[model samples]
Target: MDTTEADESIKYTVLDNLLVDGKEPGSWGTFITRSEMYTQAAQMNGLISYLAIYIGFVLVVACAAILSIQQLSNVADGSRSYRVLAQIGCDDRQIRHSVMAQQAVFFLFPLAVGLAHSFVALKVIIELVSIFGNMSIGGTVSLTCAIFLAACGGYFLVTYLMSTGMVRAAIAIRYSE
Candidate 1:
């Protein structure tokens, strides 16, 4: 028969060298057991690691956004480079775009490297786990990617907000003069 019927029949059938009577239903009745417990324990560790990495990613993004905001603020506050740029007749829009572009570049560099490293490192780790003759090359990787993309999206949003504030501050300072 099909797998479903064969599997069910095997579960219910007595062994030729019978130990326990197979007439009894499986103990714990579909409930989790010791194996399930260890499996869940391993999964929990992965979840915890994921969460720690997630927190680190958020902190990294926050720091990058803050650094970008501070640099933009310094430029807009008539710093040396600001004076030099104004002498060249670079308008306010140019200044704003320059600030945003710099932020984008800075944010993108570490991000791209981190993403590549995450995928490669995890792939290696999975392979290593299998090579040691213990755990198989199983579990999930796409879950980590999803977490990473969410963090990146949050970073981008924060970058946008910081840029908007800096540009407004620059415009106000420009008008005041």
Candidate 2:
């Protein structure tokens, strides 16, 4: 038989098998063409990719917020120390620089550790996936890293600004009193 005839025969054969015993075969099984299967797989992959991106966003935001709040609270508790530094001839620039340094440590340490762990995990994932097929994730990794770093940098800048403001306010209160 020609290819067209063979293809029609296979289609009919699948339909016939599915309708066996005339019981509707609803609970027995179902038929799926190769293309249909591939389509479903692609849809699932898209869903999973979206979910991962969403979860990553939530995690990055949560980490940044938590660190920001923690650092702000520390500044609040240490307001008197800042006031003393200002009284002891430290300039505003110096005080702000101090706050910036502290904020950098608080923000970057956890990020560094997380990145290290992620690298190890990704190495393992690459090894496993390589067994199935050759894969190149360089562009995806670079894009994700760039986005993540931008978010972190934004959060860091905001936190530093807020901390400096709090420090200045504390010093002002000291001087006014």
Candidate achieving the largest TM-score:
2
Error of 2 at 143 (Å): 2.0
* Candidate 2 all-Cα RMSD: 3.4
The C-alpha stretches of model 1 lying farther than 4 A from their native spots are 1-88, 128-140
- Count steric clashes of candidate 2: 0
Candidate 1 has its poorest 10 consecutive residues by lDDT at: 24-33
Candidate 2 per-residue lDDT, tens place, 74-123, comes to 99999999999998999999999899999999999999998898889877
Model 1 collision count: 0
User: lDDT per residue, candidate 1, 1-177, as tens digits?
Assistant: 975566555555633223445543453244344445677878986797679767866776676667556555654564445445655787867876776677667767777887788778888877886786367644445665676667666766676566656565655555568
The residue pairs that clash in candidate 1, if any, are none
C-alpha local distance difference test of each model: 0.63, 0.84
Global lDDT of model 2? 0.84
State residue 114's C-alpha deviation in candidate 1, in Å.
1.8
